[model samples]
Target: MTDALERALASLDVRAGSTRRHTLPAGGDIVLPAGSTTLVYLLSGEITGDLALGSGCEVDAPTGDGRPVSGRRTLLAGDAAMSLGCRRLVLSSQSGAEVIVVTAEITPSEIVASLPGTVLVTGFARLEPAAAALAGNLGPRPDGLACERPGDTVVCRSMIRSVLLSAVRAWASTGAWPAPIADPFLARVAAAVEADPGHDWTIDHLASLAAMSRTVFVERFRDAMGRSPAGYVTEVRIREAQRRLDAGASVSEVSRALGYASDEGFRRAFRRHTGIAPSAWRARALTA
Candidate 1:
């Protein structure tokens, strides 16, 4: 995985985007806004951070983990889960630690499911996501690793997503808790959703076409994908939005194409899920 990191990073077009790297002194605190997803990798030294995921929840090292107070280590060397959108976030580092905090300009599920490994560790509030999914964990490259680059710090963010999607697919075949996309009905539904991103679809309608009772369909959908029917639908919408925007659709046009009742609603939802406004993201992600 380490060896692959460099190459993977090189392949990513992040150069078109922007990232911030910091050498945080111990006791440093950084504030992050609501509805943003970040990937913090401990390149060197230990660091502990706090998270506020809204809904009156907080992720702190001292009081949350319920570990032995005396021997508590605030931060260890590792990666943080992809934080889901929430109210705010706080991060602290040891006296002299090096870390790469990649504030992703993408959606939560889009980036999380696209990580390198199926099994990923998250932050305290679970605001972050885990990469370790039960997927192909199958495919052509079980040993594929994150990409690396020519710099002091290595950040193969794009490569990680590719590897994870592959891993998740592999594990699905083995019946990992939530199986991968192996069910034919589910596959058909996926195809249908992708084929008609503008369709005003419903779960009941999908269930009928899939030839299963609504209850059965819901259960199977969750069992196979680890997300509710609506959740998956939202995912499809987000992906479709990306495609349309990349193809040069205005925000309103993209929203209308996705059957969104209002462009404002689409914008809000897009920011909540992707951590950036549609226009800003599109400008950076798909420039000719």
Candidate 2:
């Protein structure tokens, strides 16, 4: 089976949106709200903070050298933090600090959900040298000037994208988070489903692909993936449907491509998963 991380990185898509810089005076505190693609990097000085994560959110920090000691911890220069969902990060600077906050949108949004909701990388420069170099290359663009220049924006976004990828890679290498599908057998099944979501992936077919009996496959798949095989297939299909829809595919076309028996069936499944119909979701995504 292909390495899980490699597969995830391959499917990952990120688009940089807005970038902002903040300078906090000594003894000042700031509340930063985090979204699915938010990243905060400390440029200088130190700050202490606590993360308030919402339901279904998770936090991962270093357990040995850089771990947060309690509910609040301090981050030094070159440190970074990210949250995959809605969160409130309260930061306080003792001797002042400079930070850059960036927002991006990631596709295959499920990848974000699979990752830890909160990631604190203390001493990030040491852990991810190349990413750190990219961050350093940004220097200090006065008053967010980079965002104003189209060419500079492109270069900045590219560097930020690399930083995000490197951060994920560093965290994943630590094995602090669970792989989406840990079992080799189950991973094979998942790879096949993802590679061809339109395939008719019945339990029997999936089991055969995994070289296991249906019963064993079902049990193990649930254990590893936290959902039944059928549910997983539905999830994969819906995610692909979203991607296709975002790419300007019509609802009917998506339904057909994903092997739905009828447009109505696809519509129902899409609404159940996203709480929005395919057409509406496409419109919103396109406009956004």
Work out candidate 2's RMSD over C-alphas: 5.7
TM-score, candidate 1, is 0.44
Question: Residue by residue across 11-55, what tens digits does model 2's lDDT show?
Answer: 356777777677889998766665556777888988887654322
Residue 200 of model 2 has an lDDT of 90
- Worst window of 10 by summed lDDT in candidate 2: 53-62
Per-residue error for 98 in candidate 2, Å, reads: 1.5
> lDDT by residue for model 1 over 1-288, one digit each (tens)?
221222222222232123445567768755555665444455456765443222221123222321112111244444333333354556666576655444444334433344322122323212212432211111122244533436413224443453333322222222222224688888788668767867888989889867899999999989887788887777677766766676677898899989889989889887876667889867865542
lDDT at residue 15 of model 2 (Cα atoms): 73
Q: Best TM-score goes to which candidate? A: 2
